[model samples]
Target: MSSVPLSFEQLGSYSPMDFLTPHYRQQLHASLQYLQRPAGTLLLHKGERSLAQYYLLSGKVAVDAGPARQTFEGGSPQAHMPLNGSQPNPATVKALTDVSLFAVEHQLLERLLGWSQEAAYQVSSLGGMVEEQADEDWLARLLGTPLFGRLAPSHLHALLARFDYVEVEAGQRVVSYGEPGEHFYVIKRGRASISLPSAYSEQPALTLGEGEFFGEEALISGAVRSASVTMLEAGELARLHREDFVELVRPTLIPQISRNELARLSQQGSRKYLLLDVRLALEYRLGHQPESLNLPVANLRTHADSLDRDTSYVVTPEGGIRSELAVHLLNQLGFDAYLLGEQPPLAA
Candidate 1:
């Protein structure tokens, strides 16, 4: 904490967030809050659930650990980490002066920190088949995804049972634009190229190597194929029919959140919920929610890969099934997604 000089203009300068890489810290920004509190406040209490990680950015605080009491001024090593990080705080902390602090949900901070550390060092093969990896690695990748991560092990096993296999040759078309999207394909071996067709030529836009997946756009959006995938090398793919995919995968992936609930979340700190408006650029420019990010639907699939997984996104269009479709697609890629919609309240 002493590394940064206290400055009102640079909140991050005094934050634990300063230690994290830019990419990792951006993911936590939505769930974190900055606060200024008056003196004489009990910043923390003994035996209270540790709901958040509190860092004393600029403050004087006293900690009572049983019979002993110690004072920690701002920038001291004793105040570097959250006080009483255990489930129930072991001691009480009281503010001795007006203080500035940063707080983030304890569980969220831990999860993102773990993921960031893991992802930072992870190395994977671009050519190894999905099923060829060690069981732990292969399964973890499946469970790490947004759509399948929450599924029970038993459900995942059952879902895998429904897939059938096929081998494709180099230059073979897996799916074509303007055709009905009837199946989702998970690559088992080799690589493929994804192209979007316009006029007389198909422009190659992405490459899908082994262990990656494709063909989700049609199923999630219920639209004709938006692009085509052709094998770049002889490959094997596991295919799941649209009906089976809908029955097994869609229900658990998409969420319908009410306006009031979204409002309540927004007021919590204005950092947790991002109301994403995925309409055309022109439509979004006309009118949209305050603070919403404008990403048109056509580009959503491409840009979704870059979004921070730690933040919760409420994807919306001019309210209808369109919003649901957008959220559903986001969920497939492991995004924390929810849709803004209306449904009658249940009787209490």
Candidate 2:
């Protein structure tokens, strides 16, 4: 028998094992097997029954499914057949270098899934190898996104773990206005449309493709969706539940405003409050806070005189650096200001 002992910490880097209770890790460890593959090997093919899920202990592999392509390079692990569903499109898995892998068969996994928490831990620890590889794939893609740029590494990993991949067909309504929001979605492939109701025709606010995200506001605020989002074509998406939204997305969004600060600000009447909407005139005309004064961020400096020095200005921009910068500009101008909100809003 091989005498190599697995390292749990190393595996945690690429898997959701870190999020699992300690008991589950022990369960996984008992049923896991370590594997080593030489270079130039085919791990699995598309449409093949997944007998076992494999995790890279050390090495690399490339996965291609039709137009969607992802490569799991060395130093990070990769997982095969982690999800239960129809077989994935036949994907050619090629080792870029000599690879070390840990595997757990579906039968053993089935037994582990039904086991007690302690047993689950043992199984999970063993399963950690596969989980880590899957995690690495997700992490690689997530870290490459601009939306996740502001996040710290730890926070980013947590968010990645919470997301589940989903696929939708063209013309499917992913989200509907007035429906309770459940998950926030990020487009991984294909395109989607953001639309809102209108008398003549539904206004398409935007068309987004790879790396775009939506439903954040709904997730944060727990409010009815404000717009309808439909898949423009068959596509893949990464979805984060509301619970994950609070844990992952919310912390990275606009910095937290203190309750004391909010209370103090609320005591001041509306006349003392200046709501600045910094979106385009057309967007402002489409919809906005009725009381807000439209002074698009671009024109704010030129029209500085439009703002009142006695009032506390509240800057709002489409969720991004624009609004944050607006606040900075107001501060530099000796005006008291805070960021209020943005358009095409994200969840609170």
Candidate 3:
């Protein structure tokens, strides 16, 4: 076992790590686990499943695959890739010398890889359509948003194709409080303020600049808009109709799980998942699942950095927009979250 300082530069040298965008690489670095094993230690037996993708940082490891045996050394070109492939590793692996390794959750690695590929494809698809430098800049910023980063390539392309461009004048209200949410809007060239009705005095209004988005809460929950969005200046916007948003984006962004399924998952997995109630603290105090954690949806952005990325969160379904909004925010922040379904089947 060893305590070695691993820099971002050394991390950048790994295969898929080299392929990831800087932003994605930084996100991966936050929760990456550093591991070390002494010489003669058994890393993995043949046919054992690996939950993480491990990369050799230093020392030597011997791999035995059937009749073939090979020794891999750290800093070698061969060591730049994951020591173990997907689950059920075919090779028996042992540390030949004291070894240092960095392990990324297998699912996390795959998700980041998928997003990286989709982002590159999106850039390519833009081609000659990016007319101005400013347009190019905003497009890049838009791509960096968590919503866009998480979308499947097909859904991304389709959503991009379906957006309707709109021009807004300063002080115009795009969507007002209590109105049904008709569209999800992405700011292309302007600023806007989001504020709830005067009755909700506790929460302050928020400003959003270009490349930011809004209105998803209403669309996802089938509820009226809780806040009004007013343009601060004349700006361009790209809006997706509610139907399009639901059809093209909802499936990927907001997955739902029945209560029974969640119970079954808890019983079957070694990993423990958590239930999150996203209603306000007062609302939570009135009634909430005893085991669930209460963190209001509005405060999720501010508090989410402290959350465990390895744990999956199930948002309670009772709060409608509040719960769904929390799921969206959590997913955007790179947390695994699912909405609890409204109905659960009778126990057998």
Candidate closest to the true structure, highest lDDT: 3
Q: List candidate 1 stretches off by more than 4 Å.
A: 1-138, 147-154, 199-204, 270-274, 277-296, 299-312, 317-319, 328-336, 343-348
Candidate 1: tens digits of C-alpha lDDT, residues 187-207: 766689988777525434689
Please say which candidate is ahead in TM-score: 1 or 3. 3
Tell me the tens digit of each residue's lDDT in model 2 across 1-348. Answer: 222656665544535444433343554565466666678876666765554556665667777666887877544434532322234425656676787666654433443333322333322332222354543343334433433433554455456666678878999999998899888897767799988767426433689777667887665545688689999999778788888887776655443233344344455121256667777778778777656777777676667787787676776555345666566556545565666632443322
Cα lDDT listed for each candidate: 0.67, 0.59, 0.77
Q: Which stretches in model 2 have alpha-carbon errors above 4 Å?
A: 1-147, 199-205, 256-348
How does residue 293 of candidate 1 score in lDDT?
A: 84
lDDT of 2: 0.59
Using lDDT as the measure, what is the rank order of every candidate, best first? 3, 1, 2
Per-residue C-alpha lDDT of model 3 across residues 230-255, encoded as one tens digit per residue: 99999888899999998888776776
Estimate candidate 3's alpha-carbon lDDT, on a 0 to 1 scale: 0.77
| Candidate 3 segments whose C-alpha is farther than 4 A from its true place | 1-8, 20-52, 85-99, 105-132, 255-273, 277-312, 315-325, 333-348
